[model samples]
Target: MLFNEEIQRVFKSDSWKKVNKKLIGKMLSEYMYEKMIQPNILSEEGENIEYSLQVSESKHYHYIAQKRLFDSFDVKWTTIYIVENDGRKEADSAIELLVDLQDVIGMSSETAGHLIKEMNSTLIADAHLLEKEAKRSDELIHEDYASLEGYMTGHPWITYNKGRIGFGYDDYLAFAPEQQKEIQLSWIAVHKDLASFQSVEGLDYEALIASELSEEERIRFDVKVKQHGSEPSQYYYMPVHEWQWKNTLVQNFPEELAIGRIIPLGKGEDRYLPQQSIRTFVNITNKDKHHVKLPMSILNTLVYRGLPSERTVIAPKVTEFIKGMAEKDHFLKEECRVILPGENASMNVNHPYYTQLKEAPYQYLEMLGTIWRESIYTYLEEGEQAITLAALLYEDHHHKPYVESLIDQSGLSTEEWMEQFFKVVMEPLLHYLYQYGTVFSPHGQNTIVVLKDAKPHRLAIKDFVDDVNISDQDFPELQGLSSEFKAVLRTEAPEGLTQFIFTGLFICHLRYLSNLLKNNGLMEEETFWSLLADAILNYQSRFPQLEERFKLFDFFKPELTKLCLNRNRMVDYGYSDDDDRPHASEFGKVTNALAAFQLNRTVGSN
Candidate 1:
């Protein structure tokens, strides 16, 4: 009865069926790409293929799909049908297909059961997205970055992307990014003995607090801290998500609260909006203020959206390391002028019991921490706008891509716009990988594209605490790195390091953009990929001295290991509470689409 109004408004039968069909199409396409399903080809016409999959003796699914490069499929959702002994009907249930494929895909019953909840949650979110007052691509192109994120759909590849396990409907309405709700953050005081605060060389706790909180709010918070019989100087003030404080900290840290080691200090004066990541918040009251990242215990995408204790402790150091490189490199500082919005400060509070317990579940250890990242607004020049790379994949209610609107507004042909896009995004990423033996997981959310006159002008990469990785191979650039950094940051082999860019950016994001553009008749699929290949090659030509490193981190190999996100949760790492978080699963190898362009370049030159 409480959510009767919401249920009536958002959960219409027609909307459910429509969102389910779209999700079914996504499941079929992604499952095929991951090699989880191999349907027999019924017929073929050019790049279009008709396939039939038999789930049971009498149950069959038939659909026509456009076969894209990277072994991906774009299934025509309306064309999908389920054939049974009785008759034939439109395929409209994603959960039904998921259950039917459980045994076929070797999913355990426990995993299947959990996946059902996640899939249903995803469906509810999708229905709300359908019912919300949607924006057009043209209008959204001019919107500010903070407000624009709410219009986006979640991850392009993952099926259960919005499966926020810990959220009730009330929490979703209050705090979900798509809800576009702005609320003041709740502050907590942790005794200095139990909390650790770190920051860049020039900034400290006092300066950070002064910048973040108004004098009146600080006084009120200090008075509350004193009421709990603790000196203001003996404690560190940390901003926390209201949901995290209510659901996670109260139950987990009861002893600390009872002893007055942790005190609730009420809400701050500034209002903030949650971003797509859900854990990060942007200050809506003051655009230039630092964006706050707090630990939320929701299970979304693959892992709990909590900041690991080790990463939080070392975040500022990582910021200094990355920003220091850009300060010294002439290309990064002057020519390309790439932006790195640093995670300049952080506060981490480890659970007393979890810290003492060996091999405790990771979720328990990461329950309390905060990272303060420099605002993206601080870096924008006049006539410049910043949007996350994910915005490009967004489709308006009319199914027009946001990127297409930007291209139209830029007064550039699709090819010209895409060329500038690749140069802006790839040059900085490649320079970091080839020239300096470093890489960031430049996935949609982590990478930001700065646009000028509606065309990409530069790149901004963030989330250094979680995403930045280094090459395992010894390189002079990394020789001076401290052992503390070596312990906190992940190190990868040559191919593994290259996968961060190749699979993270090209395969995960650009492939979808290429498909969208081709389907919309803006550009051919081959031309789209060829332009990206050209961008990488041009960067290589500029830095011939890094030829050996280029080969070591080659992006044009004939095949590379295929990473699967859905398969990771459903087949390999189910709902187990493990000491470490789950990662993307590696299935068989996938043919490299860029390799063909490289061959073409070689033959044309010869």
Candidate 2:
């Protein structure tokens, strides 16, 4: 197959053109909002907004965007143009947009070139996925949870959403979530020396493995292990990403393979569909089986898609602590039915070299691990379904938002549907914040929206160890939580923890949802923000005793710390192939849309 032919086709196709423009528009708008570039604002009258940025004296990037609430941009895809000083106009491609803004964002030549490559893979992946026509609103409305999950698009806020930098074309086809392929992971036997498996009380190593494999497969696996002269008692079995085994581990540690310390035990029987997060897989064979999250050493988006060895050990412990807290709280258990899908078990293999090197970056220490998380499907009731919160904002081929699809089916007015929607999502989140000073980054992908009859139900939160955080203040509630939980969970100040909810739930997820609502004329942008305020305030009025906790972490603070994702990429090292996840850069501020609306509501009452 000619590589260039395929590449050119994806780049030039009508769908690719639309997808690329949307991506470019998003990158330009977000980077500008993050203060990476100062665009000359030409005009703003209601939604009719125009801006131009000087990439250089000779070149300019121009766009007409409908300004959404919180100053987000919904750039008109067809209306973007790159104007040359020589009086030539060119339609913007994904790569061209990155190159144009690279200098403006103060990125080095090296970073610019690398970012272009990232865009190349991203566009290529988009090309492969975008060819499929979008389903009708009715189709998406009736879509099964798993199928609907596949329909949901990439990160609502990120520009280089599909940049799986470490993947080759073949790897992209086999492992990337967009491919919708069933991946059967290869198992590896790690001698007792290098491997450590941690688990919550009930979920042991044997049970977790048995749940994923049939009895015949388990017998076959044990037979293969015995033929290799290894006993189950002596070595721990860990599931390895098949691609990671061939591409990384086998080559990196030939000594371990030769010494029979790390022996491959062939593939497991279960077929898994890669969830939206790329590394996390949902068991398609048995939906109730735990979601297997393995470390794939690909550098994607902001970090290498690898799990930290240190955190892996404590993941189950942390999950247990959070689970106990959720079940024990009346608001969480009785009212909202919040489900914290426990990270039941995890296995981490210590790096042979990185552990010895004091200053090595974190990803090197994170290259190999697995976290077996309890599946939310295990807890779903009859007629209940769960979809990624990202799907709520998803626009199908016919440009229909999933929420609107649901509203139509529920036979409820838009306001009632949306009110119910916000209550279910925000109630548990606010309960955890005020009742227990706990915070989880319920970003679009991490948060799951459970529903029945296309109406909002409750939330099922996952990705515990990495995504969840706790308050620095020692609440009485956290008294008996294990020392491992205390150590593993990041203790941030009340305000800092507030950012997890403010930035994660509000900016990362709700901002785009708000745009979808406003764009479709389902609701005004201001009303959407007001509804969010109403969600939190209504939750607040129920537990008056937690008012101090609410005051401690004021959501109504005038400004929020802007998480500059694109700017974070542009400056500094531009990212390492293997390093700790970079710190979020606070570039600038936008008016707290929630605070603004809440203040307006209070003033209106008086």
Candidate 2 residue pairs in backbone clash:
134-397
Candidate 2 regions exceeding 4 Å error are 2-11, 44-46, 86-88, 481-483, 577-579
TM-score of each: 0.99, 0.96
lDDT of 2 at 270: 82
> What lDDT does model 2 reach?
0.80
lDDT tens readout by residue for model 2, 334-412: 9888988899899999878778986788767877889998888888999898888888887767677778888998899
Best by lDDT: 1
TM-score of 1: 0.99
Q: For each candidate in turn, give its C-alpha RMSD to the true structure in angstroms.
A: 0.8, 2.0
Best by TM-score: 1
